[model samples]
Target: MNERAPATSPEVLAAGYARCAQVTREHGTTYYWGARLLPEQSRRHVHAVYTLARLADDIVDLAGPDPGPATAAALDAFEASFWDAVDTGTSPDPVMAAVATTVRECGIDDECFTRFFGAMRTDLTRRTYDTWGDLLGYMDGSAAVIGEMMLPVLRPGTDAVAPARALGLAFQLTNFLRDVGEDLDRGRVYLPQEDLRRFGADPHARVVTPEWRALMAFEIERNRRLYREADDGIPALPGASRRCVATARVLYARILERIEAADYDVFASRARVPTVRKAALAARMVTSREPMRLVHRDRAALDPLGGTWVSDDPVVLLDDTGSPVGQAPKSAIHHDDTPLHLAFSCYVLDPAGRLLVTTRAASKPSFPGVVTNTVCGHPRPGEDLAEAVRRRARSELGVEVHDLRLVLPGFRYRAEMNGLVEHELCPVFVGWADGDAVAPDPAEVDDVQWVPWEEFRDDVLAGRRTVSPWATEQVPLLAGLGPDPRAWPAGARDALPPAAALGPAAEAA
Candidate 1:
């Protein structure tokens, strides 16, 4: 558990947030645990906003003694008072006080609050939505606005809003899926009526019938797509904020897994992710090398180290023909055991035209302590080879490369070291470093040094230095081309092997 050291603030603001934070922790277990991944300053603000939303929600749904009209009137009054307090920069109500402080401090837009309350007002009268678009209209205000509100705390790029909106809708839809039975008990069905009819599902059919199962599966797939779309924007955020959002995304999405585990019997039992599992997931993020990688895999290509080095991370599994047949956890790939896959080797050169070389960390499973090119990486499913080269350079060496040129597209190799095999139809790239200093990530490289290209070639040829078998063939071939990368012979740039040509013959060669 992360401990927050007490710091003094304006008494009213601090007291307001303290109360809101407690409310957040007590009710929203999954969100509370995920928010804990954020820095205390941002975390408190998130709690305050969530508390404000939760309070309004309670007024609409949990004002038990009041009828619908009374509840609606109460909600309207609460909104009016909350906004008035926000405008005046003070609120006697504890929740509003926290909300005011958070909005002012984080520079949140009042328009976001306007949109959120609009959705809350809808819940009063709307019993059933007719189409997917209508539900989306409802969620735009209800769910998407929440994502918009939190963007300031997350601090992602301006382009982040679209994905943030998708993620919010995904989270809200997951709740709808999990709470189907509970929602029914409250005389409501959150799933769109049109979708229900399209799938031959009857809202009144309380049992998990086959039609209902099919419908749930369809909706689950839809939600998964939304989650993927939302995940694309997470990396644009700051590091800690990315982790916090990623943590929340993974844990919340796991509820769908729970529902599936129970055979889509969300009605019989509400899918709940336990607090212990939530803690373990958060702990895993802390220990994992690339914590910024989000819950979704397709969007993970943008993450520098998302698919490399880490065993459980997924890599594109290619058939002998170099076409992506599927993906496998990287840990599952072993020497000669798994089919040959597509990979890329990148070499970086300083302004002086010196090539960077790195020793594989001793802890690496294969070729440990062997020297290699600046870095080697496997492209995620559908990732471009040149893009992968640049990604690995940044992740492993903490350096950026410009104008990566695929110098040897037909490069392929198969070598066995210790018990593991090295077989790849790997493309070779050359890129100039953006700066002189190379900061090596210790997990990936044991040591890094820049050596003149000619000197490195001579050392490798003379057996004065140990190099990975792929590099053994590659470095000398690169040296044959010459000193200036831009001036390298055009003949050296072979066309990449077509998918059909990457067969066992290439592997055995």
Candidate 2:
């Protein structure tokens, strides 16, 4: 719902909105890219919301390490002044004028602002968070409230309070993870102290030790869970609003990817999505209805296949520790927010060490017709992943034999193809075919080739042969294992995902 413009003059509101847009662009490019997909009216409201939050943050932070008496007083005054504008429905301050207009037009709840300011005030006194819960208490105001504030502007078809708040928390957590080093320098550490002790990680050292990596990996998993929770609210949003949120969510989550690529090193430099990519994503969201034509879930376009709490071919659900919590059917598991599950990928090689490349059947539902590794399939609940690899190899490609060893035991990725996601903790295995003969399954692999493993790896690295997203990442790491796949060092059974229980078939490894 929208209301008539506040009595604020058109020239004044436009200038205020223009300033707000600049602030969003300068400080929050991901947000700007997402809002670019919104209609002009909603976009303006987003700018106003961001403007108020950003300026308030500036009031709290611009004083740097020495936020003396004036800083708290200034923050309180800014908060009071914003409310005054909201109360009068007008303001002499240009940005405040636009922001107040948005508050009136969008019917944003005043309580959100109450929590938000309260959190900002807490920041002035509180420096370290003792546990995840403690940090969440502060984020409830500093971050999650931002989502509630945006709900009125988003105008979801259904009430999306929980997911929106989760999305806000996810975004802020991502920020905390990416800015850990910066925060530490500022006499604050957003990471939970309990988690630090549990992992035996000392962020104060600012080194990428194994313990630090473990801690970061755990935190990243928790962050992704929030993103998954937020995905439920996406379908409830319509048109450009949905596009806006989806683009922003995708872009923001990518920062975690960058952090990983940098070996979870936040101290060296800020990990970020290049501005060019953000613009390209924004353009794609604006131009194409499906964006990537990979993960389409537009409610008006297609009704999703209904899922149940229970599953027939169950996928072992995992907690943040990568341990199974329960199960959901393979058929019912995947959607926009596919849960991370246990899966295995097998890269088959012929006697000559030539890699077996397979093209997925064109008629398949997800990632149809994509060329990828020899076999990729999920482990049945309680089934061994090594056995799953062998089963998929025989069933999908009709070839497999010796050297069944895990190569990338920690291989995990999130990818979308043909409207479904393959979010899995997929351990990769390398095996050699016993014989040269092959029979590709018409239902799974319609075509197959035996490319020299070196040539395939080089082509993948050089962008000559575009395969699956997993393949794109796997090639480089596999190359580092050895020049020849036949001689690569074998991975031990202890490295498999916690849910992938070892069975007799896996004992062969």
RMSD of each: 17.1, 12.9
Q: Residue by residue across 1-509, what tens digits does model 2's lDDT show?
A: 22434678899989999999999999988999999999999999998999899999878766775577799999988998898888887789999999998888889988899999999888677778898789999999999999999999999999999999999999999999999888776677889898899789999999999999988877886777677678878888887998899888888988988999999999999999999998887787787765424123322113233222122467788775578888987754675457788877888888787888999887665577899988888788778777777777777777766667677887888997534678888888888887678898887777999899889998999999999999888889899998977777766667767777755454223
Highest lDDT model number: 2
Q: How far off is model 2, as Cα RMSD?
A: 12.9
Model 1, span 1-509: residue lDDT tens: 11222222478777888888899889877778878888889999999889988988888777432237788888889898787666766767766867876787778888898889889887776777888788999999889888989998889965799989988998999999998877776667789898798668986678888889888877776676677668778889887787788888888888988988899997677799888999998887776666654364423223222224544556666666666677776655643234587788877888887888899887676677888888897877666666667778888788988766667777888886543566788878777885678888777789988888778888998999878899999977887778666666432332664431221111111
Full-model lDDT for every candidate = 0.76, 0.82
What TM-score, over all chains together, does every model reach? 0.57, 0.60
How much lDDT does candidate 1 score?
0.76
Q: Which candidate is the best by TM-score?
A: 2
Which residue segments of model 2 deviate by more than 4 Å?
A: 1-5, 291-509
Each candidate's number of clashing pairs is: 1, 0
Error of 2 at 15 (Å): 0.9
